[model samples]
Target: MTVPAAPFTPAPMPERVTIYEVGPRDGLQNESAVVPVAVKAEMITRLLDAGLPVIEATSFVHPKWVPQLADAAELMGLLVDRIGDAARRMPVLVPNEKGLDRALDLGLEHVAVFGSATETFAQKNLNRSYDEQFAMFEPTVRRARDAGMDVRGYLSMCFGDPWEGAVPVEQVVRAGVRLLEMGAGQLSLGDTIGVATAGHVQAMVAAFAEAGVGVDRLAMHFHDTYGQALANTHAALQVGVTTFDASAGGLGGCPYAKSATGNLATEDLVWMLRGLGVETGVDLDAVVDTTVFMADALGKSPASAVARALAGA
Candidate 1:
């Protein structure tokens, strides 16, 4: 008697996924060479053309910290008209009250504030203790929300940190809860150092769920340094996280973490999501074309597999 093998069943996933494109902000922030405002505007326009519903346009951080994004105000001015589009959003990073003020002055309606779960990263990045960092975020979040702006919070090093070996899942959940309570409409869990494994991702998401933070209020941001980003994203998807952050052409890395590489590439995420029959409303071919154009401007080839394959084909 010949035994028939069972059919392989794909894991259940969300019917539609929302990709938060962070290439213009996070991606360009790490570049050693500064990109022109015109080029940055073009990238944003092309991303919108590719149908990305949410794009992080720029950061209001101090130039001393990230000179690559020094033209943040200028960039915002260039996109002032597009900011009025109701179908899409352009969220800018506001580090504190000062950053928030700059964003508000530009009439920006959406903003993101960032914090870290690990003490070392908080100290290194913000030059403050974890508690102090949250204190800073409180007023920023309050003011931003009071101004009627949609606020998103980013909790970095949620799974692992370079200084701290492995982060406890509870620590990340606590940070996320605090951020959500502080008035963040959405929270993004970041693997700042690219040390997250699929198991770590699952455990972290489960921990958040246990804390009463639903998957609807959360997003995933992974780095490809260990080549585990896609695997980790799969773990997140299985847990019902529909929003994932990606950088077009895999453009950025953490300057604070030297070993950290580019983010999970937008093209790669779209490729996986499309194969899973998940809808992202992103045109993969158009995204690849944008990346190809960006790579030429940056004088390098794209870091995404899909972009490379498409370019070759």
Candidate 2:
């Protein structure tokens, strides 16, 4: 076979980007069967070895709500013992003050809280109204900040909501600004149903910039239900957003939003970034191998295009 060469020019993007791995928490939560805690620990270990800087270890949400991660405490204990102080780089999601208390007891230094931009999702996910959700997060963020923990605020349904059709950019910005004002060090905007296109992403980020939210404090979390996650990511990169939320093997979806699908695959993102001459500090081969291992554990093939192609090869 003759090798065909395709010449390309790279787009202007950040020199180095941070991949916030969310497979262990967000990915596993939607699993129908509960994954063994040991398997979860090994997965995180493998991802860390693959050079993912910040991995979401688990969620402190009630077991009744997310039973998949019911072993949050035990998993964190094992991870801390195995990785030592590197556990500081692993952030856990906290739903409320109770969740924050659980994380604090673990000596965890990093945490995140999930918020919704739409009223219906807020009621379904958090059981609070749009404006009322802030009250729920206020104390948790305040106490976390007091403990010197870096709190990340996740604003879901930034582009579209299932209950409500398209979300206004102004609505997302207003909700996101409140999270930052509540002491969240970073704000991750979520395209919850994966209905966002590249233009919508650019406009959303631009709106945030107009509201005085710098790119440094923003992260993009895209879902590939419509096969638009990577394209949306490229749009984000064009605007200088340096952090992205991805799941190993593309193994995450929103449990609350039934229409939501798997997250942007870390391997796919790494492949694109490598091709673009962007630095992400990720080992592509290691990530593919890890995804294969996890796929065996789950009895499902990886959803990542890169992982599927590399594994078959």
Candidate 3:
């Protein structure tokens, strides 16, 4: 029984959407068990085979902070040697100048810097105040741009924060614009706690648009904590957002935000887009199989509803 999402025209959606697969870095980083470098490499290759255009490979953050990705250099080396030019399209998260240096040494063409929208989250996540965090990111973004590497900026806690109940739209817009001004090619707005609803998502995207940042320069990263990830994604799509950050099989949550849960599942997003007649270039069946393989590697079942149902079927 191969049940599809039943193709139908919905609200205006982008003709082609770019799915930024973050399972390898953001997904595997929170795993309690450290996945072997070879296994991690294989996951990237599998994701590429499944037609994901942009896959975040690994992070160069210190091993002390994120032990799960301690094998960042090794993993990237294996991926480059195994996949050749395809590896160039993969981006890695770099927390600061030091991390950026590590990523540069590997000749990675794309890198992302993580920032926070609220003050409390900034202190807790980046060890800097909300305004001060930009000073830290300026040099890293500048240097990465200097190296001719494509830079993506990740703004966490855009919708709401654990310490701060609801984030102001103006505050989020301000911080996001700063990142864009600092030379970030694309800014990923993160609903770190999964507290966003469809209306809130539309309002936030609209606020950014009013701030002179178009949908062309923004991406949406949502978590499924309140079961609104897909709904929120739909809202973003209706507003002309074409890039979405999704994890394979809903593999990751924010390690810093304990209340956060798994991200929007790639299989689920692809199904909705398929029904809406939007092209993601993803094979849903291949993504489900990859999730099953990774779920077994993690010694647990996948958290994605679509993956569980489709894999079981």
Per-model C-alpha lDDT, please? 0.89, 0.92, 0.91
lDDT of 1 by residue, 1-313 (tens): 1111432329888889899999999999888889898899989989998999899998999999999999998888878755455312489999999999998887788999989998999998998899999999999999999999999999998878888878888888988899999999999999988989998888888888889999999999999998999999988999999999999999898888787789999999988887777889999888999999899888888878888888872
Query: For model 1, what is the alpha-carbon lDDT of residue 216?
Result: 94
lDDT of 2 by residue, 77-122 (tens): 9999999888756899999999999999989999999999999999
**Best candidate, lDDT-wise?**
2
Give the per-residue lDDT of model 3 (tens digit) for 184-271.
Answer: 9999999998999999999988898888999999999999999999999899999999999999989898778899888999999998
Off by over 4 Å in 1: 1-9, 82-88
Prediction 1 global C-alpha lDDT: 0.89
Stretches of model 3 off by over 4 angstroms after superposition = none
Q: Alpha carbon lDDT of residue 38, candidate 1?
A: 88
User: In terms of TM-score, which candidate is strongest?
Assistant: 3
The 10-residue segment with the lowest total lDDT in model 1:
1-10
Return the TM-score for candidate 2, rounded to 2 decimals. Answer: 0.97
TM-score of each: 0.95, 0.97, 0.98
